[model samples]
Target: MVNITVPQNSPSSSSHYKSSPEGLPSPSPPATIKPSGSGLVKDYWIRSTTCTASSTADPKRKRQLKVDIPVVSYGHSGWLTSSSLTTVVEDPWKEVEVDGDGFSVYCKKGARDVMEDRFKSFVDFNGQHKQAFFGVFDGHGGSKAAEFAAENLYKNILTEVEKMGEVNIIKAIKQGYMNTDSQFLDLNNRGGSCCLTAIIRDRNLVVSNAGDCRAVVSNGGTAMPLTSDHRPSRQDEKQRIESLGGYVDYSRGVPRVLGLLAVSRGIGDQSLKQWITAEPESNFFKIVPEFEFLIMASDGLWDKVSNQEAIDLARSFCVGNDKLQPALACKKLVELSVSRGSVDDASVMIVQLGQFC
Candidate 1:
């Protein structure tokens, strides 16, 4: 384990993490702001010391400036309080012409000191109001696998789409996964697998699985899973791995690969990659505009909570006043997972489609 210590700044100290302009107040107010909807609230706290000030003249004394105001902002801090959830209205797809077709994303890293997990990207092409959304990478063995997927999977898929054309989306998705896996192998000896699912042209969704991470779409309040869980215990996966010269170890009847890894497929774990395959197992579904919501989460979440349980929790929140359903759902999922004793790092992304979109 690598120890990374972040230096703490004293409230009175003038370090970069807590520096303000001369004459400005040190330490700014927390970033936590209430959500616009009723009974829904979101909050964030940032530790910093950059403040802005304004002066006003006293009513009785025309020549006297009697009021002093200080506003502070900082870039970094030691111990900051942040809500487990975040929602953004920005265009992850960066489509300008499409009015209401932009992407909405919500993310939360549950209960961990650091957010090592990553999320899929939703991007909109300039002319395509149809939209493209992807839940493409699930990191395992370490954060590197997840981070790499979050950062590059969308771009890789887009590139593949461009080269192969939309008629061959399945081919494009498969090639993209294989290419991404190879890239990870080349960059770092340690690699991870990804389970990718995407909504294309706002009509169909394609799912590709390589690891245990799961993607599920809520249809009329019922949970419909979009991808399969690729575990070594699965008969077909075990046969494939064995055919590739890989052996499964069963210690006390609990099966594991090499007695350490559990999943049958992944992008990294170079030592295991040779035995493990990167070829994605895929499925496709036509999306109904009336679909309630979509949930993508890491293994930490699924390990502790059932798909139906997560779906019910998200459905419960959907009826409330929270307009930021995605973020709220993610927060609730994380909380529930922690409550159920999920010690590993947990991350989730919820995407909700409005009727207008």
Candidate 2:
């Protein structure tokens, strides 16, 4: 299991949601599955592989670009089974320890769906290699999906990376996202979640994302988006959904697929399975010398704050006094988003790439 710094929810995380006894569906597993300490991994081996799109030069027009992001087959409705109890984290802001300058993470519960956003950060050890993993999940209807992904997604990524012998890191990240989604779906979960994950290995930073939760890096004082947001209203996403026989409708002044979920890609959502997917878009880059810091958050923060604004605020605070304080930066950003009016569940993480002082 990945060692993640989970955010302790406010008063609502425990009281607002249904318990595992109430949430767990039919076909409950045998008593033997639950051991003395080990949780869900004892009996289950999750499997998943997400698709990747590539950009190639057009045959006829040499300068033109051709994109190809493949999609894996999905037919695992039979695997749907039971889910574990809900996971909770205390404290809204704190420092998650890591080896040699690890990043800082901060989160704030929103008004919708029992503080649906969740995150995880840790170094992987159960694999052939060691890599730092950080993920942020935004749940739409409930916290179950987000919680499950946070607990199990990093492990799956480590598994896939080991399976491939680390030949292709991008493929492994994609597969990790899909595999986690599969595990959540198998539990017969109701809500879907937007996910953004960043993996650091040997000074390389790889970002993978499904749905709108995002990652932004400070490159030479400019906010550079590592993963693009996948909202249903986007032309490409709308076209893809329409091709799948799914239509996008406007409600509450926001475009949604079939007038339902706002994001086009995510985990769970059995009803929107045909259109919404777990496939993730990945970006690969080295943690160059120009890299200053990284800010990752849900749409609640992005909706109110731009990439530059967030970078400026965090950088200014990181170097304000005697020493760097990424934790403080994350806290300030979350507060700013709320002050600017973000009604959704707000979550933010600041990764200090290098010391500014």
Q: Which candidate is the best by TM-score?
A: 2
lDDT (tens digit, per residue) of candidate 1 on 118-178: 5554434313554655563544544456666655565677689889998888888788778
Q: Which tens-of-lDDT digit does each residue in 277-341 have in candidate 2?
A: 89998877778877888887888777777778888999886654676667678878888978876
- What is candidate 1's local distance difference test score? 0.53
Runs of candidate 2 with Cα error greater than 4 angstroms are 1-101, 124-130, 319-321, 355-357
- How does each model score on TM-score? 0.66, 0.71
Q: Which numbered prediction scores highest in lDDT against the true structure?
A: 2
lDDT score, candidate 1, position 178? 81
Estimate every model's Cα lDDT from 0 to 1: 0.53, 0.64
Model 2's lDDT to the true fold? 0.64
Q: Cα miss at 161, model 1 (Å)?
A: 1.3
Q: At residue 179, give the lDDT of candidate 1.
A: 82
User: Each candidate: RMSD to true structure?
Assistant: 15.4, 16.6
